[model samples]
Each structure stands twice: as structure tokens, then as C-alpha cells.
Target chain A: MTLNRRAFIGTGAAMAAALAAPAVRASNHGKPRVIVIGGGAGGATAARYIAKDSKGEIDVTLIEPTRMYYTCFFSNLYIGGFRDLSSIGHSYGTLAQSGVNVAHDWATGVDREARTVTLAGGAVLPYDRLILSPGIDFVEDSVSGWDVSAQNKMPHAYKAGSQSELLKAQVEAMPEGGRFAMVAPPNPYRCPPGPYERISMVAHLLKEKNPTAKILLVDPKEKFSKQALFEEGWNRHYAGMIERIGPDFGGDNVSVNPDEMTVDIDGVVEKVDVCNVIPAQKAGRICEMAGITEGNWAPVIPHTMQSRVDENIHVLGDASNQGDMPKSGFSANSQAKVAAMAVRGALLGSNVFPAKFSNTCWSLIEENDGVKVGASYEATDEKIVSVSSFISQTGEDADLRKQTYEESIGWYSGIVSDMFG
Target chain B: MNWKHDRFWGVLATVAGVGLATPVVAEQQDARIGDAEAGKEVYDLCVGCHEVGPDAGNGIGPHLNGIFGRRAGSVEGFRYSKGLSREGRLGMDWTLETLDAYLENPKALVSDTRMSFDGLEDKADRDNVLAYLRQFSDSPQNIPESAPTGRAREVGLSQETLAIAGDPEFGEYLSNECTTCHRIDGTYDGIPGIVGWPEEDFVIAMHAYKRKIRPHPVMQMMAGRLSDEEIAALAAYFGDLE
Candidate 1:
């Protein structure tokens, strides 16, 4: 109540309100249609910002498969009980209210030459510019004995919602002293810190319900983002409960047997109570189908996010092969602003400033115990380069950790508002 | 002044009630007081870690509600770093000078702060951001000696007495140059929609470029050619847009 009261008397609208959602206009017949595929952080923000800033000058439509979009950013926190699934879920009502056409449909194909996106319903939506922010999709055959068919039993849970629920259920159902094995994905995956955060969360849940349970992380990469901080957290709270096998120790050579729920690390096979097999990932199917893939991801100019293959299309979030930025929701949100600005400028001729981007990734090791790594970036000719960066140090005091946790909470709220609204 | 403009004075009245009128220096700023409207844009740099609304809880940095002259590191529910706490105990109130210094380089000022921001380097940008923060300040603090004073009666009556006032009609007449770059209907070359902006913001931005506080050489060259009234007129015309 105090928070609401405080907000009521506070100065003008918050930054989220001030920046996007312009009051300009044009009729559909004359207005340029901007189609955004995906309703996650990147898509929603881009759609809202374009529509708002244009004030009806540019027509904007958002195509998403689901009406209730659950964010992948804090899904790990949900597994660890820091948040409920509903809290991380967002709807398109605000975007619709702000004058965006929110269409719930799968984008089946992009007729690049025709400049139209054909939806699953067979309706073709024309656009002056198309923004593809389809989040990552797991590489089908990247890991042996692991595929989408076995996802229900040995869940990847990367996309959030049902998969996340399944993984959390599996972690919860584990017996005391049981082995919970996680086959972490390789580099160029969505949310670089995500797998480790999931590990920390599962460890927290296990420590509470099954204290002696072991967390076995089979990591393909030799080093990970925030490695020191995560290592410190595991030592401090979940000490002796987690062990990581990096590439040097055959972490790269791993296979899963879903029927038996066993993970074979190199030549050694280990039976596990629960298995989370996160495979190598690539841009979503639609991105590949659209023919934007240079390989696993679409290439885009770092400044405008315009696809290198086609200037009319912009690829954002994990799907983009922009330099130096992680494929995280935070990064998506940051990139969306730049793309939105560029898109609007291209279509409506809105005043545009230089592209500026920032990202912060937070991981919760325990309740009220969190750490973060973040950076400020500028778009250079070669790539988006980091200008300044900071990371939480190992063994930080409780107050700082608590502060970091609180900050994550604040960032979550602010970013969600910036995206959904 | 119109009823819309009166709202600022009304908000200031509440602040002035508990406000301290300490003599201030524009030591870190220029002759012109920065505009809060433009400052909001610059605040984008700090948005990564700090939260700025009244509803904002402590983020990585403290929620900066009513931060001006608020005791350093004294926001309720926030855990201040040890170095920051010492600054508070040593009686460091968040004055314009303190804020300017902190924004210049947080590490140098606090030495042991746990904040992740590298700090905002430009002084003019800092002044603009501070102006933005001053709006939410529950109680007013310093009064810059250089700022307009004793113009209360004139403030609500004539544009001449207003600090950043402009005549929209005159601005419209002189807006030919703006048209080539910024189209009247909010459509132009990769340029943004300058229409419907607050006059104060437009003035501050032009001043930022004219003063070379910001980095755009083209903007600096263009802004350098204008007089204060001409800039104000242009702002008024553009502000009247949308």
C-alpha cells in the first residue's frame, strides 16, 4: 500500500512510461506495418516501443504462439521457489491497450521478397520491416540419447512454463542423497548463466528437501560465466553437494539414457534420480525457415540489428549473432530498444540517437543470497563492444548479497514493465 | 502561465514547505540550469542498476526517491555499503556537489562502494539528470545562486520571466531549418520525433550540444549558431507539436 501511495505522489511517469508509446498516428492504409514475431522480452518491448513512439504513425503487429508468455529469465528462480510461474508470466493486454495488434499465432514462414509473414492460420501479414526475436531452440541431435521426445522425462526446461514445471517437479521428487545430474549446454546458448543458475536453484531446493543429494554438472565448456561466484556460492551454502565435470574431465563426452534415467560421462555411466539434459541450441525454427541463418543464428549489424542478409528484417534476442552480448532476456530487452529506434526512424522518421545497450545477469545461489555480472556497451563498426563491466566478488558479505537479490527483484519488475507495457 | 505550467509551481510549493534555502554554487554546472525533461534521457545510463520511481525498492543501488539532501546511504530498507555508511556517518548529505562528484566517478569518491555503475562522466549531463531527480524530491534543498529567483509573480504570468520560456508562434515562424531534418508530422530522416516534447527539454538538449557537453559534433555546430531566444522559440514551436 505504501509503495502504491508513494508511486501515486511521485513525479511524472516512470522511465518505462516516458520512453516508448508515442502519441503519433497514420491510417492503416498509409501507415507502415511493422511485424514482430515473438512476444517475449525482445518482441514485446519492440512492438510496444514502436507503436507508442509512433503514436499510430506506424502500424505494429506482434505474432506470438502463446497468449500467456512466461519469461525464461527468472524461470530458474521459480524452480528454487524465489518466484511462482505466474509471477514470471506476462500478457499482451497492456500492449494491446497501447495500440499494438497482438496476434496469437505461430509464424510459419516469412516471404522475404514479398515482405510478408505467413502465420499458422494461413493469414499473411505484410510489413515494411520484420523483427525476428524468436528465442533459442535446442539443437535436435546435439546430444546422444537426448531429444525433444524425451524432454518430458528428462526435461531441458529452458523455454519456461511446462518444461520448467517438469524440471522443478523432477528436482522435488528426488529422494534424499539421490544424484541429480545436469548436462549443461555448450557455448552460444541462450542465457549463458542460465544452466549454472539452474544448478544453484536445484541445489537450494535439494538442500532444503534432500540435503545429502548430489548435483552433478556435466559442463561442456571448460569455464563458465560467473564461475568464481558460483563456485564460491556452492562452497558456502551447498558445499560438497555439487560437483562439476568440465571438458578436461570428459564433461564434453556425455550421453543420457532417459528410460533408465542414467547419464554416461565419457566411459563412466552414472545412475541419477533426476536428469536435466540441456543440449546445444540454435535460433528458433522460424528463423532458419526464414533463411536468415548464417549457421545457428542470424547475422545482424550491431548498431541497428538489421539482418546482414536483408536490411528490411531485424533479428534480436538469442536469435541474433550480434557480437559481445549474451543471449539473455536482459540483452534482448536492450537490443530491442536499439532496433525499435532504428525501425521507427526508418518508417516514421522519428529522431534517433546513437545506439546504447546494457545487460545484467543475476543468479540466486540461496535465499537472499544473489550475485550479478553486468556491462555497458556501445555499438562499434566491428561489433557491440563492452565499455565497462562489473561482477559480484566471491565471499561478499550478506548485506551486499541481500542487496544484490533485492536489486534483481527490482530489475525484474522494471524490465517486465518496460517489456509488457 | 497556463494551468499546465502551474502544476510545476504547485509541486514546488509542497517541496518549498520543508525546503532548506542554502546558498548553492553552480561549480560543477554551467550558467543555464539543466532541464529535467532532457535529463530523463541521460538517466538511461544509470537505469541498469538504480531504480528511480517512488515505488522503487532498493535495487543494486538505493532507490533514489527524495535523494537530494537525504542523508547519504539512509534510504529505508536499503543496505548501504560500509564505505557509503561511513560517508553517511561523516555527515555527507547528497548535495548537488556530492552527486556531481559521485556521478563523475563513484569509485574515486566512495572508494569502496559496491555499486556496479562506472559513473556518468559529463558534468552537463549530470546537471540534467540532477534536475530530473529534483522533481521527485519531497523536500527542496539548495537554491543555485545562478538560478532565477524572486520571479514568483512573473513565473505564472509572462514568458519573459520564465527560465526556459519561448513563444510557440515565433518558434513556428522560425522552424524552417528544423523541417529539413525533423519533419513537422514526426517523420524525418533517421532523426527522432521532436514534436510534443516539453520546451524545457528541447532547450536543455540544444544547450547541451551548444555547450558541447554531449558528443555530437554536428549537433554542436548547429546549436552553436542559435541565440537563447531563438533556441527557446524553436523549442516552443517543436514542443507545441503533436
Candidate 2:
């Protein structure tokens, strides 16, 4: 029905207005938006899984400071003079490919009531569901004389990267027969076996370069990760090179003198050429600010990885207090999946399935030798508890060790692919 | 007048037929229980731990060879908690009613029981497990002969089946991952070497990871990536090495 110019304009405007009305309604329709903070193992995996599985029903956004993450899992190999940092680093390009809106910014604060995450760049990203996996924060005040400035002299290579490099350099540059002291923090920390693993890697390096060098491990606890295996290996391979001090042997009590580069144990001040002070850690600052952290870690429901304090928010990875589960990359990744499912279910109004989680940590004693510990967990009440667990028995045969070493490598590739590709 | 009388007689006959059917339906409902033949199908989940054969050794829990007449904690070689042993000394035997109750709610029946199981919630499931338990006794009743086969063989292969198979190429790729908590040459604490260990032991260890019987969080996450076939291959590859 051809008509005059005024009549045609009026019809076109009416049709356009009708189309625009639905666009406005669509923005406020269907499922809720989920904003994930951090792009490490937990955060990245949650974002990818949620975005991909939501089938465009839920909006997902990931806020991370960096585009690439150098994993702390294999960072020790780099410190031990075996692998480079590039080999362990992963990028978030695959996450972007999964249709997650990756925002390159640090999450400064979260508005729990409003359900919005405030970024460092002053952007308030709104979310119906929020998942936080920002990892750990070191307790600077726990050490008597150690602060931010002292980190340069006595590096805590707990978080990997430059700190790991610094520690490696210190070990490399030490004089022959130099005393290397490692002050391990108390229990309930990230990577329960990490400090012990570091000692093994460092001892491996020392045996080749400085045979007479002394590696003194000052731990707060008497027994440590894979206690039997480490003792067997030390006595057999690094005889007289490593001395471990537990609480019974005056290792638990530590007073650091950062200015002097010295640590005192049981009133005995020992000056060292190299010192690695791993301070006590807590949930990342964001968790503390959100009031999710009870003491140093966030308490979460194991089945869903949902925050106990706020049901709308879910916490995962090293930041969470999942009892009996050590803070490791694998645990973080596993938790991310549980969190993803819960977030998806909550947003879509679907049934939340019970979550079963598994974690494995492989530590290299030397170049090819490896040992591991693993567990499976299920959520009970409000916390994750171990349903089953395994420790590699003492005196493993050569084939088992060799195969385990191989399995460890395969796991790394698989997990990195699963998390970030 | 003849047609109206015929329709009324037909309606009265239909009412009498429905009235007679109610009592027959009630009798059928009462006859469903005590069917041992039907109970065998419900007992599958229990056979993994409790075995009936003479050659069957302890598989984490005690053998059920004479469980019906035996006291709860009298089984030797199997560690029983003081609570269970004390209860055993008091002369506790497995009766049908007690067994039914215990099987229905193990933790409630015996608090702090180390069974690690939340009892069978379904009445039919509890009845079947009880029926299956009864088959192992000296007095065999009308138990079904068609119990599922291959359960014992499958239980034995649980660990072997769970290990990750080693591929040297994949192994080399995985070596970097192992360095986080394991050592190849030097040992510091309790971390073991992985260079030349037996594949069978490695496989068992990996199975432990999958089963969550191992206590480490790190290994649990790492083990989650492996498939059952991949675990076997990894185990075979590792077990074959020197």
C-alpha cells in the first residue's frame, strides 16, 4: 500500500519502536550475569565452564590483571635450574575463545549488597553471581623484622615469578659450602608439601655445584609432606647436605632478622648466605574485604564452592578453606568446576548436582624422579572433607617412580589445557 | 418397561463385580515381601567390600563368611575400633531384625562406626543386602542362585584399573608437572623419587588418587584428568620399566 511521505515515515517509526522495545526487555530478561574475579586456575576455569555451558543464557565476565599466568606448580623446576619460566606460563586466549568477556583489570573491591565488583580502573561490573579465586596474601607482620623491603634480600618465592628467580640466583651465587636456610611457615597454608619439595630441588642443585653446602630447613612442624620418602632420598642421595629442624628439634620457633639476613631458632641466631622466608598466608585481600574469610581463608560449601557468608558469591582455589585439601593448582582447578556448575545452576534455576572433587600434587626430587600425594573429597555440611586419600608408599620401585614422573608431566599438560589451553 | 428393567440389572451386576475386586487387591499387596529371589538384585553395592567365598580375604572391611552368627568385632587381622570390640564382647549377633535395622542405618545403629558408609535408605535395598548376607551362612534358605558374577574379579582389579598408563612422550611432557612436589634425584623431606619405580606400584598409587584414599589434595586434582584406560596404559608403561 504505497502512500505519501508523511504516512510512510509514520509506519517505519512505529515498527522501529516496537523492535527497540524488545531489546530493552531482553537486557533485563532470563538468566543473571556472573562476574568472575581473577584469571588463574580457579577463576579461569570457572569463567570458561560457566560461559560455555550457559549456552548464552547467562552473561559471564572475567576480571584479571594479567593476560598470562606463570603457574607456581612447575615454577620450582625453573628455580632448580631445570626448566624456564616460559615453559610453565599459560595464556587466557583460549578462555576468550570460549566466549567469556575477559576484562583486563584487578578487582579492587566487591559490593556484596549491590552484587557488583569494583575494579581498580573504577569500573563497577554488576553480577548476579560472583566467583572469587584471587589466591593468597602473605602475613607480613608475622615475621619480626621482615617487610616489603626485606623481600629483595630474603625472597619468599611462594608466589613464583621474580621471587623464584631471585631465590634461584641467590642459591646459584652462594660460595662453596654456603649455608642455605629455609624458614617454613606453620601448617594450614598453601601447598602443604611445597616447602619440602623446594628443599629437595635446592638440594639437587647443591649436590652438583656445592657438595659441601649445607641446606637447613627450619619448619614449624616436625613431620612434613612425604616424610619417609624425603628422608630416604636425602640419606641416599644428599647425605650430610640437608638438615631438617622440626618443632621438637627447635625448627618451629622462628624469629627473623631481615636486616642481618639471619633467622633465630630457639635463641640460636644463625647467619646465612641465602635465606628463603615463607611467611604465613591468608585468603587474598578481596576475600577479607568481602568478609568471607574467617581468619586467613574463606569458608565455602564444598559441594558447590559457594561462600558460606554470602550464598550469591562462590570462592575457590587457594583462597578457600576447604579442610584437608591443600592449596594447589589442581585443587583450585577442581574447585573451579564445582563453582562453575553451581553458578550455572543458580543463574539458570536448575538443579545443583552434588560435587566430587579430586586433587594430585607431583613434586620432583631430581630431574626425572618424582613423588606424589592425592585425595578425593566431597562436600559435607559446609566444608570439604576427604572421602579417600593415598600416599606413595615408602621405597617405591624404579619403574613406579619413572612412570609417576611421566604421569606428572601429562597431568600438567592436561590441566593447563583444561584451564587455559 | 422390559428395556428399562434390563438396563438396571446390568448396572447392579457391574457394582457387585467392583466390590468383590477390592479384597483381592488388598491380599496381593500383603504377599510382596519375604521374596529372597527378588532381594539378590539389591545387594550389588555391598559385594565390593563384604565377600562370601571361602578364599575371599579381607578387602578393607571384614569377610562375611559367618557374619550372621559371629560377633561384630571378632574377625581377626581386621582392625576393629574399641567401640565395635566392646560391643562384640557383649555378645552381639546378627539377627534378621537387627541386621535389617543396621543395614537400614549403620551409623545410627552404631554411632562412630568406621564403616564410612551411610546405610541403605530404601527398604527394598536393605532387604536385598540382608538376603545376600544370608546366602553366605551355613543355613542357606530360598536365596536366589543368580547373584551377579564378576564382582570379586572386578574388586581385585580396582586399583590396577585406576592407574594412569605411561606414555614416554606423555611422560616427558608430564615430568615438568611432577617437579612441583616430587624429586627425581635428591630428597629433602618425605617426597620420593619417580625415576625408576615399578609400574604396578605406580598404578596402585594412581588408583589411590582416583579413589580419594590418598590424603594429598595436589595428587587428587592431578589424578582427576586420567581416564580408566589411560590409567591402565600408564600403569602398564610404568610397570614395564626397569
Candidate 3:
């Protein structure tokens, strides 16, 4: 009567009978339980869908440290002045009202064998299924001379809350005509186009606020997400204000001194007014504690999103080594639904459908000038693979770009509603 | 995704004889119910290219035996048009509503169906022909003498046939993809409100996107993957929203 993954996947009647068995009766009285760690795009969507769709049949608990979730997707817009900080923040109240037991606390550790998660508040909760969508965490010491202790001096602003506000304040506080330097992360990080988009927003702000300020971008990668389109926009709008040093030109060899406010590229050292350091990222530490991650990420079964090491645990979003899809909010949201369906089918004996995933990423270069890239994905035996894709073309009409920008606004409203509500 | 569930229920009802058909059909009231005796005469239009019943096999078109709940273009050894094969890959299925649409206008459904017969304009004739064909199929709504048989891929669809009653349960699952970018609360910001549109308009607009007649790339990509039945389901789900 263990009701392991094998019993959960048995025929509907057998699974139903197992749920009715007395030995497995829980505090909720025989209802299957799911515990979700992290409450961003992936975790929030997964928790809400399971609770919303199960109709009180299953108990769902969402453990997130923040009561108000600030999305990283539109934080750049806040930096650029297109949106306010309040506009990008959402609360778990709606999800709680809709049946998810929202627990606002940090998940400190996971015990896979006992199927329990320990919170920072010293409460231990058990689960029939565990979903880890904790997003990205920086690889400590990956960047020389920089660590979390140095964050106050040089903000990463990658997590999108206080750090975003801090970054914006720093940019606004820069001295006239001062230099702004960004140490961009290497390949395999969150949001493929994020660093470039931030640069666009930063440039937009400087053009209006401090016209003569200089921007120095040091990249470890040879090329980035939307290189041609970004290059085209940068040249068109901020022609002489920005400079980039790619890996071919010693950009890969970089170090920053937060105390001195200087950057060393290969051997040359230069002083800068502000520094944004985005280090290499890995799956959040909870995945490592659960012993599910391989190297930097947790590998999952493409169809169910279940961790390869343990069937009862599912890894999602920026944390999972899913193929072809970018590490964006949209991809995580899409993956959440598939994982929710699989969990419901396993627990509630409900029908399961094939996994269909899609993602679209939009970046605004300047006022009313936005571009996008998107693709549709299907789960194959080995991994989720792209089936079809589309991207915005260069030199498009202003009207089209405006429409794309407006469309992105609509998308933000839509995705936030999908996540929070 | 829709067809897999349908096929699962179809197999369960056929093999277990477990009285699962009534609930399935009750949930989908628009499925296979008409005067089969009258449908026999209306099916004469299809006699030239298609055949059904015990001795039925591939003809000018694939045989219609066990057509209900069957995947489109999936008959073994029968060469199908590229358009129909593509639809099959896109997850098209042969269900009661889809059959009626195909009977009403073959080109409207597949856009390139090889059958050149003029469409039946009367809804009664289409319904009766589908009811007549239902006798040869193995849905829970009908107890055919032979077993249910067909390969399934995925997808659901329809054409200009406006009377389709989509299964909202299936729509709820598919709507997850839509709610990501389109608010379920019907709030319009940069994206238009899709809630409460007439089912007919919803179906037509989605078909236009599927055909690339619509201008938006994201919409075209989303609609292109949906089958006729899936379109009908979304229309039903959104049309009824408050």
C-alpha cells in the first residue's frame, strides 16, 4: 500500500482503490497531496492548475518565500520607465482563494525517500508528488572577485525585485557622461535575450536622462540571442553611445572589483560608474539537496517532466534540462500545464493528454519599437523538440513594431493572469 | 490530445461493455444520433467513391467502415491526398460533427479533399448520412457488429458547419495554452477579449488563422495546430464564459 509511482500509474480503478485504502489516509483524509516549491511562472501555474482542475479532490500546497512575486520578464520595462514596479508584482491571494494552500516560506531542504519538504520556518510537509520550479541560482565563485556579498555594490538584478529597484536607482544616479559596464553571463542562463533587453532599456533611459553616458558590454559568448535585430536597433537608435567586446576580443576574460568600481578585461583595467554582474547559473539549490540535479540542471522525462532520478518528483522551468525551449517565463508556464496533467492523471485517475509546448519572447529596443521570437514544441521520446518557429524581421514598418509592442503588453497581462489567477 | 481520450473511452466501452457509452454520449449530445433508415438514402451521394458495411474495403476513397471516432487518412494501404494526410498529422479525426462538415463541404474541411462531389446543403441530410455511417463505426453511441479500428495521431476540427456542440471538458484542458496570453477574466489590454464570442464566429476566425488568411503569426501558429474539433471545443468554452 505504498502507492508509489507504479501504483499511481496502474489502471484507473486500481488507482482509485489505492486512494481509498486506509493505511494511506492522510491529515486530509485520503486525498492525494502535492507540494510545489517556488512560486514563479512554473510553480504558480502548476499549483493553481492542479488545485483548480482537481475540484477539491487533491490537496495542493505552494511554498514560496515571497508573498508578492515580482516577475523577471517585465522588470526590464520598469528599468526603462515603460512600467512601474507595482505593475509587475503579483500576490498569491488569488491562488489561495482558488484552493491552493499558499505557504509563504522558503523551502530549505527536500527528503526524497520520505516524500517531505522542510521549510525555513521549521515546518515539514509531506507530499505524494513534489514539483521543484525554483528557477535559477548563481554559481558561486564562477566570476572571479564577485559574490553575493558584493551584490550591494554591483547588483545582478537578475531576480527582479529589490535588485531591479536598486539597479534602476544606480543607473539614475550615475555621474554625467560616466561609464556603465555589464558583465554578461556565458551560454545556458535564464532568458536568452534578457541581458540584451536590459541593455536596450538601460540605453533608452540614458538617452533621455543622461545623454552622454557611455555603455560597455563585455560578453563571454561569441553571439547572443537576437544579434542581428539587436545590432540593427542599437545602431539605429543609440549609435555612438554603446560598445561591445565579444569573446574574440578578451571579453571572455573578465573580473570586477565592486569596491573600486572597475572592470579588468583580459589584462586592461577600466573604471566604470556602475556594474551589473550576471554570473553563470544553475538550478536552484533545493534541486541539489533533493539529489535530482545532474551537473547544473535536473534531467527530466520529456513527456511527464518527472525527474530522471525519482518518478515522484517533477522538475520544471529554468531548473530542468528540457531541450530546445528557452529559459523564459512562457516556456515554464507551458511546461507547468503538461506536468499538472501528468500529476493529476497519476493521482486522481484523470485522463492525460500529449504534451504540447510553445514560447514567445518580445524585447523592446526603444519607444514603440519591439521585436519577437517564438516557436512551437512537441514532446518526443528523448526530449521536447521544436516543430516550427518564427521571428520578427529587421527594417519592419513602425506600425508593425508598435503592434508587436502592444501585443507584448497584452501577453504580459495574459501570462500574469494565467500565473496568479 | 482529444482523439487519444476519445479512443481510450471508445476502447473501454467496446471491450468492457461496461455501460460507459451512455455517459460519454450524454456528455457529447451532438454526437451520432439521427434516423439511420432515412440516412441510408442520403448516403447514396457517397456510393460512387466510398463504401461501408461488412464487405467494405478501400475504393476511390477509403472505405467508411468504422469511420466514427476514426483518425483522418489512417486507413492502411490507401493513398490519401497531401492535404488530408497533413490534417491527419495535425491530429484530425473522423467524428460525427466532422463527418457532417465533410459531407456538407469536403473542401471546407480538408481544402483539398479528392472527392469532387458537390456538398449536401441540408443539415438533416448531413446528420442522417452521418447517422447512417455511424452504423458501421464503433463509438460508444453506436454498437457496431465489428470492432472499432483506426490509428490515432491527434487533433480535432470542423468547417463552416455551424451546429457543432464541442466538448467543454476537453476545451478546459486545451484552454491552458490560451490562458497563458489571453486572460480568462475577459479583460482587454493589448490583446482583444476572446470571451463570449458567438461560437460560429470563433470557429470561422480560428479557421481563417489556421488557413493563414489571418495576418498574425502567433495566432496562425496556434490555430494551425488545432484540429477542427479542437477549434469547436475552444469556441464552445469561450462562447459560454461570463
Candidate 4:
């Protein structure tokens, strides 16, 4: 069928109002509670969108154990000492201003049948719809001898708060000519190109401080996200400072000893002054309890972001299975919009418009040079498929790189405004 | 008198049933060619190449007037590659059904056409464009003022000399091989440099094909075959020169 432009716009507006009216009526009926778990990019955006779109109709109870969220997007800059932690770490005061009830409590369990959330404090909050965006829980067993305590010596820095700070501290304190090892995760992980980007940023930092210092990357996959661009950037900017270990070069297997800050590889134990191990991940605990997560991640219908297991609950961001879309801040934000639109359709008895999602990930290769890859996606029955994709080609014009770097910052601001403002 | 009254009552009931069904039947028959007027606006992007008029020069594309019945790559003063002429022999035509399938997904229909436009995603737009094209030249009486020479003679080459590697009988065999990725009709994308391409250019391109130069992997493989003489004969056969 053809979608008439006028009809689409009218339906969108009507759906918005339809979503708003119930929450409005419910507010007068003493507020339909909305308890959002996690305060990362996905959870925060979902909470903000629900609060704003519902027009104060929703009493949004955001349950995040952390007082502030430090974005993983810009954590590389913090690691490089280009920016401070305060810059990336954001508070919920802005959410609070939008009439969200921010609670510093972890969600212990979800009573999905009763539609109530059991917080750590023994207080039960009832919700008309529970949005679970609790980000990811790293698989500790993937790497031998790696556990919570082991992270004290060798930080994962996968989540961008204390781990990030500790990783940065270790990098700063490393002696000259020391070795820094970063273990890369396999495919279908959050920020597919993030580990490589992190390596680039760290190499950039290490070049001036300790010229002899080396950054060794061990990866299971032969090819990585944006392989051409990353190799070109590494060769041009940080020549000889970076060594990549692909599966072809016997880099597939990884065994780490977190306490020793060493990784054993193919009968050789390489001790490093600093180590960053990004473990395998799965959907958060809430999704497991809600029965939405199949094994590790939630299976969602691409068109609606509705859970395949339960239609009443919709999953968004990193939790939902959006094929070919890396778990990233930009992707999470895009998924949130789709989820918001679907939520409006479910509540208003209106048709959900077929959505088109697009995302771009920018990696800083040096202080000035950056690489980007992006794609537009459409939903099918099974998964979200790429309609059009583009990458900043190797040896791109200097002006284009500068323009893209600026575009990345602008996109970041625009997306943040669209979500929280 | 009672029997006559019963007959009259039965006749009235039959008429009433027919009357009730009349609008529904008519509605089914008169289905709106689904908003062709809306489709006209969407057709703006397509008019650049497919326009029909006396002033329209066969640019990189053929004049699309009376395209439905026309033999593939038969346009005069325009050159077609071997892929198109081969396809024409396979009884391919620009039928409405074929056009609909082509417009929805071009590459899926013809893997090696060069038209860069992605398929129109909206189904209604496809229907509208199809109707619009039908309105232009469905009848031979409305055909544009263009005469068709024999398909072989149009490209300025004779078929006998061109049939060096494969016979004219083998043209069907070669054509079968071509239709795997090429379209006889002009509706396919990526296969564009197919119809109306220069004969000499085709021969040179095939013989000179190299890895990574042709952009598509299959073309590179196909081009790797055939001696230079065979390439010329195939080019001549496709140029429809006889």
C-alpha cells in the first residue's frame, strides 16, 4: 500500500495525542506509574521521551543504581585526557525537571504478570508499561580467571563510569616503554568498532607520553567493523605503535588473568602493565525475568519493537534484537524513537507507521582525524536490514574528514536534544 | 389467479437481489487504476530518461514511446549490447506485470543492469506509474512516428559475419545465458548499459574486462571468456547488424 504524506502526518499527530490522552486521564486518576530501569543512553532517552510525549500524564519512576551516567561515546576522550570525567558524566536533574521521579535504586525483580517492579528498597512500584533498558551484563566466563574482583587490577571499561576512570588512571601511571593489551570481543557486540576506536585513541595518547609504549589488540574475528578506515588511520597517525592480532594470526583465543594483569595466548603468557578486557554481553537481568530475553538478548519484532515473547512489553536500545545494528548510543537513540512510536500505537489503537532508522558511529583516530560509518535501515519480519550504508572511504579528502567530525558533534547534540530537551 | 400472483412475487424478489449486488459488482470492475494522478507526481524522477516526443533524442536511453510491443534493443540510430539482443530473442516484453516486478526490485530482476535508481518502495506509486505508462502507448495506432528496420540491420552490421564464435542458432543459447543477469526489456536496473550501447564500445569492453574494473564480479567472469573475434561476433549479433 502507498502511504499518503498527508495521511502519514495526520496519523502521526493523532497517534501522539492518542498516546497523550490516556496518560493525561491516568494522571488525573492519580498517575499511571512508569518505572524505567537503567539510566544509560537507552533508558534515559526512553524515560525522557515517555515523560515528554505523555505530557506529564505519566509518573515516570526511573530506577537507576548509579547517581550519574558517563557516556561511553566520549569516554575515549577522557582516556586520552583530552576531556575530564565531568564532561561525559550526566545527572538526572534534567530528567527531574521534566517531572520524572528519579530513584537511586536497583530493580531486584519484575513481577511481569502483576505489572509491578520490585526495587531493592522493598517498595513495589506499579507500572502500566515497564520499559527495560538496563543496558548489558558482561559474560565473565568468556575469559578465564576474570570476575568482579579481577576487574580491580585489569578494568573492562565497557561501561563508562568507575571502570573508565580506573582504566584512565592506569594508562596515565604506566611507565615508559610499557605494554598495554586490549582484548576485543567477537561480532554482534555493542559499538562494533568501539574497541578499535579505543585502541586508536589510546595510541594517540601514548605516542607523546611514552613513544616506546605499545598497544597490542587481540581479536577473534579476521575482519572488523570499518577495517579499511581503521587500518588506514592506524598506519597514517600512529605508525608502529599499534599491533593488531586477527584470527588469521592466531588471535582468536583469549585467556586472561585479571589479578596478574596478563593474558595467556597460545602457550605464551604476555604480562602487561595495563589491560582492558571487553567481555561478551547479554540482555540485562530485567529482560531475563520478563521472559523477553532469549538466551542473552531480547527478540523483538522489527516493525514495532514489540517483544516476540510478550506483546504487552516493548523492548528498545541494546536490549532489543535489531540485526546488523551495533549496540551503540546512536542506535539506542534511534531504537527509542521506534519504541516510542510503537508505544503510541499500542495505547491509542492507531496503526504504527513503518519506521526507517539511521545511525552513524564516529571514531577518533587522532586529535583531528576521525572515521565514520553509517547506514539507513528498515524493518522486516525477522530483523532490521540495511537499505543504504556508507563509510568514509579510505584516503578521504582532508576537508571531508573535518566536515564529518563537525557533523558527528552536531548529530550528538541534535540527538541529545531530541531525547532529553 | 393465485399461480400468477406467485410468479409475479418471484420475479420481484429476483430483481431486488440483482439490484442489491449491482453496485458491488460495478465497484469491483471499476477499481481505480489507483490514484494515477498521485503517481504522475512521483513519475517526475523517471521522465528524465523515459520521455517520449519527437524532440526527445535517444540520449543514453531509448525513446520509450510504444515500448511495450517493441522488440528489445530495436531502436534505430541507438546501439545495444549483446546482453539486450540475446534477451530480446527470449520473448521478453515490457508487459505490465514485468514492469511492476522490475520497479519493485530492479537488481533482483536483472543482476547486471546499470540504472542507479533504487526501486520505488511504494506499491501505489508503482501502480500509478504503470497506469501512466499504459496511457501513453497501449495501441499500435498511438505508436510514435518511428519506423523499425530489421533488428540486425539497425546496428549497421550483418549477422553472418558476426556469427563467428557462435551460430545464429547459438544466439538463443547465448541469450539464455544472458537472461540470467540481463533483461531483454528496458525495465531492469544495473543492466542498463545493455540496450542502446555502442557496438564498438561493447566489443572493446568485453575483451578488455579486468578484475575490479567492471564493478560487478559476474561480468568480470563472463568477460574473461570468448576470443577477441568471438567478442566482435557477439557484439555484432547484439548490435543486431545483419
| Per-model DockQ | 0.02, 0.03, 0.10, 0.02
Name the docking class for model 4.
incorrect
- Per-residue lDDT for A268-329 in model 2, tens only? 99999999998888888999988888888888866567787887788989898765567878
RMSD of 3: 15.1
Tell me the TM-score of chain B in each candidate: 0.45, 0.43, 0.47, 0.43
| Docking quality level of the chain pair in candidate 2 | incorrect
For model 3, what is the error of residue A6's alpha carbon versus the real structure, in angstroms, after optimal superposition?
19
Give the per-residue lDDT of model 1 (tens digit) for A1-421: 0011222222222211212223222234577788999999889989987988778988899999898989898999999988999999888899999899999999999998778899999998887789999998888878899999999989999999999999999889888789999999887788877898899999999988999889999988866777788898889889899999999999999988999989999989999999999999999888999998988889887757888788778999888988667788878888898798777656644433335566667788889998877654555433554433456777778987887787677567767766876
The positional error of residue A22 in candidate 3, measured at the CA in angstroms, is: 12
lDDT of 4 at A159: 85
Error of 1 at A52 (Å): 0.5
lDDT of 2: 0.66
Model 4, range A144-204, lDDT digits (tens) per residue? 6677677878888988989999988888788999999988876557787788888987887
Best-performing candidate as measured by lDDT: 3
Candidate 1 Cα outliers beyond 4 Å, as residue runs? A1-28, B1-242
Q: What are the TM-scores, per candidate, against the unseen true structure?
A: 0.62, 0.63, 0.74, 0.61
1 or 2: which has the higher TM-score? 2
Docking model 3 quality class: incorrect
CAPRI tier for the interface of model 1:
incorrect
Model 3, A1-421: lDDT tens digits are: 0111221133333223322322342455578899999999999999999999999898999999998899999999999999999999998999999899999899998888777899999999988889999999999987899999999899999999999999999999999998899999986888888999999999999999999999999999776766788999999999999999999899999999999999999999999999999999999999999999999989987767888888788898999987667888999999999899878767765655556788888999999999987777765434555555567889999999999999999999999889878
Question: Which regions in candidate 2 have their CA more than 4 angstroms from the true location?
Answer: A1-31, B1-242
